[model samples]
Target chain A: MSRTRVHNFTISLDGFATGEGLSAEQPFGHAGHRLHQWMMATAFGAPIMGLPGGSSGVDNAFAQQHEPGIGAEIMGSRKFGPPGWQDDPNWRGWWGPNPPFHTPTYVLTSRPRSPLEMEGGTTFHFLDAPGAEALKIAQEAASGKDVRIGGGPTMLRDFLAAGLIDHLHVVQVPVLLGRGVRLWDGLEGLEQQYQVETVSTPSGVTHFTFSR
Target chain B: MSRTRVHNFTISLDGFATGEGLSAEQPFGHAGHRLHQWMMATAFGAPIMGLPGGSSGVDNAFAQQHEPGIGAEIMGSRKFGPPGWQDDPNWRGWWGPNPPFHTPTYVLTSRPRSPLEMEGGTTFHFLDAPGAEALKIAQEAASGKDVRIGGGPTMLRDFLAAGLIDHLHVVQVPVLLGRGVRLWDGLEGLEQQYQVETVSTPSGVTHFTFSR
Candidate 1:
């Protein structure tokens, strides 16, 4: 069965997945790279940033799960770029010409654009649909493999609230963003539904995996 | 040299220390005892609630730190009692005659009342002083022992914001309280000052200790 999974979703201690005032220049706003520093230090994340080597410990073990079985990805439009990305005609994505996603990635947006094929097997498909609708499209595109719920907090919270996620992995970094888009907002009684497992790494980031 | 410390301060994944609709009847409000359930299962916490033979694991290791070095306690008015506790002359505290805090516990409230001495060494002293002044009084009462900053989120945040705390131990409970009093508000860049250490126990709670 093709499951909907969310991996490597990082959030601050105060539950802010991404910081406020996100722009084209500052993608994560004032948060900078603080939230993702742990992942960056991992072997899986280093090469993505063009680094030579990284740690192969607990953080690397979880960070490497981002690719393996993921066939299609459904990301919020905000994850593709900053706010007002739809207004910009030339806004491809933050990942440049050859994006990290080698799957048929679907971007959820009000303004759906034509299919844009990048290098490797990655293809950007825009859709103006809700959580369930977007998941269905992504699942269909995923074929026999699983669909990855790529997020920027708003869409992740929506999918989580709707109980569409089968496997959810969130990295909780020890930092307070103070004000930002909270990932755990309206996610009351979430632990009741899933079998939650938490493990803290030496790098000072706790990984939470909620499996149904 | 008496250091100010905060221990066993539990909060939800969303950063809520206590749930909304807190009253005299429901001290922790809609949150019930969910936030402190992990602590309750600990050896130190179980005996406090009249329970016997609890787990002496990682949770207990952290839970037991509440009283060892502390001499005096400083808690917010909300922590001492509910919202309308000041109006009620008969209101002592939620901890009953033999309160757990066996020290001179200072309650920061606008309407300061006469000292209420309980059966235990816990004497509730109402004060209108700010975080710094309250710390000063608590430190004097603590003598050479360390002073503990007891919380109800607001006061803890104030003490944390004022940089009056030397050690802070926060247990991140897995559950998410949709709406409540947040503890991490206005605490941005907190990690820069303190040497943070994260450890996730098998009880599904992440223990975060920040020491300067």
Candidate 2:
């Protein structure tokens, strides 16, 4: 069965998924970009970005898990693009040529846009459907593989509220931004139960996998 | 003389400061309320909340640090209320009667609101100033004591952009909200440095104080 899993999401001490105000110059906002420092240095990141030579130790092991059998991905509008840029429908993503995900990606957006075709196997499909509808589409597209929930706190909140996500992995960095768009803002009544699957990594990146 | 200090702040491994959708019933969101579980058992938390008996060992020591002398507190509008709530001029804060902070607090917002008076010396003053200005007000109100930058991320990002914060103590708990808010988003260009002051806690609360 294809399951919706949220993996390798990094967050700051304050409680923001990504920094507020999306822009090409400042994609993740002020301190928001610091969340990916660990992933950028690992072997997993090297191959993904087409870089040469990277460490394959514990860091690499954790990084490898980020991209497994991910057949499809879902992200919020903020993670997709700026407001006006979406109108063109040609602008794919912040990541230029040879994007990360080499698979189908479903973007949750209010505005209507055509499916974006990238260099790799990645296809950005803008979904006007509601949260559950988008998830269903992504799940079907995922085949038997797992569907990754690419984030922007609001999107994740929607999935979490609907009890659609099965697994979650968050990498807590050592920095503190103090403020931004909080991911935990409207998640009060969710009655879900999760347990710590594993806890390793001494470099402050603690990997936690929770299941409903 | 600017001294580096780490005010012990506990966070879940999933990167939630408190819980989602902070309401009077559920101040902390879903599993997020448990983020402060370690602190509540500490001696510092017990005494502050007027609890008679509590753990007095290392947990207490760490918890005591959380109550570091704060001359003033800085928060964003979101931490105070919703978007237009500031227009009222009479709406104080979520904290009724006795607020958490006994000292003065400076709220960062675009629209101006009247000073909110609370019992036990807590007063909310709106500051239209930017990150630097708010820090200046906090520093003055601190009266040589440290000024705490409390929030929801945007406010913290501003202070971090200005390189004002001296120390940061982050406690990593075990839990993942999958998404809510993140702390380190827009902190890329600023050049800052830090050294770990201390790391000792049995309750999984690792204290790290950074200095430039």
Candidate 3:
């Protein structure tokens, strides 16, 4: 079945998925890629940094699930680029010509813009609508595969609170980021809707998967 | 060597150790016994509920560490009882005549009162001292054994921020308590000092241990 999913989304022990003060200079702000170092070290995301040898353990196993069966991705504008990316017509993306997401990627932003097709199958479509409407568009674009809710915390929380997610994968990195966008802000009693499973790897990252 | 430790300290995914509005009626407030239901199902803590046939797996193994080497315990006033517990001279504790800690138990409160000795070796001593001073007193009472820093979030954060903790064991309960006392507040960059370990058991609770 085609499901709305999130995979390998990283967060600190304090629940900050992304940090404060996101900019073009530092996309992840004060967090500075600490939250995602686990995923980045995986076999799936490691190739992005041009790293040859990466662990293919539980982390890589989870990271590799991000792409398979995912025909389209719906991410926030912040995940696409830093703040004011909408203003910069020249701003392509943080991930150069060939981005990792080789899917029909939809970027949620207040200001709508024309679609930018990258070298890979990845194409950024600007959407000025709520999570449900955006998901509908992405699901249709997914072509019977599945819609991936790529996140930056705000959009993920919105979808989770809106009960639009089917399967979710969150990596709990041990680092305690004091301040940032939180994943569990409005998700009180989230366990009621989804069955949660936790697996702690030898590399010190606990993978939490929630599926309804 | 004397080591300061915290054990079986349960908190929600959002880092809330306990819920709001704690009282004698509902000691854990809206959270009730949910935060600690995992521990209550363990072989160690299950005995308190007078229940049999609890699991003897990783959860029980970790839960068993709560009372092993510690000679004394220092807990916040909130953990001792409800608000205005001092006002009610009849208020002994939530744990009946034979309280769990069979050692010198120090309760941190602004309003100090005379020591209350229970049936077992547990004796509640009210102290108005800060984390450091209180640690000194507890350490002295410990007589070379380790001191367990029992908590209710605020006091644990204070002790942690003060760098007074040597070993910490936190159980990440799957529940999301939206509003309550947070364990990770003012504890940014906590991962820097402690060598952390994450373990997820079959019972669906993740155990986080930080040892300096």
Candidate 2 lDDT over residue span A14-45, tens digit each: 55567656566777776545877777778777
Error of 2 at B133 (Å): 20
Best by DockQ: 3
Tell me how far the alpha carbon of residue B134 in candidate 2 is from the true structure, in angstroms, after superposition: 20
Docking class of 3: high
Q: What's the residue-level lDDT of A91 in candidate 3?
A: 84
List, residue by residue over B51-147, the lDDT tens digit for candidate 1.
9889988899888899898999999999988888889999998887899999999999999999998987999999999999988998899889999
> TM-score of model 3 relative to the true fold?
0.98
C-alpha lDDT of candidate 3 relative to the true structure: 0.90
lDDT of 1: 0.91
Strongest candidate by lDDT:
1
Worst 10 residues of 1 chain A by lDDT: A176-185
Candidate 2: regions farther than 4 A off: A189-192, A197-202, B1-193, B196-208
TM-score preference between candidates 1 and 2, better one: 1
lDDT of 3 by residue, A31-145 (tens): 9989878877878878898787788988899999988899999998789888877788998788889998899899999998899999889999999999999998998999899
* Each candidate's interface RMSD: 0.9, 6.5, 0.7
Which 10-residue window of candidate 1 chain B scores lowest in summed lDDT?
Answer: B172-181
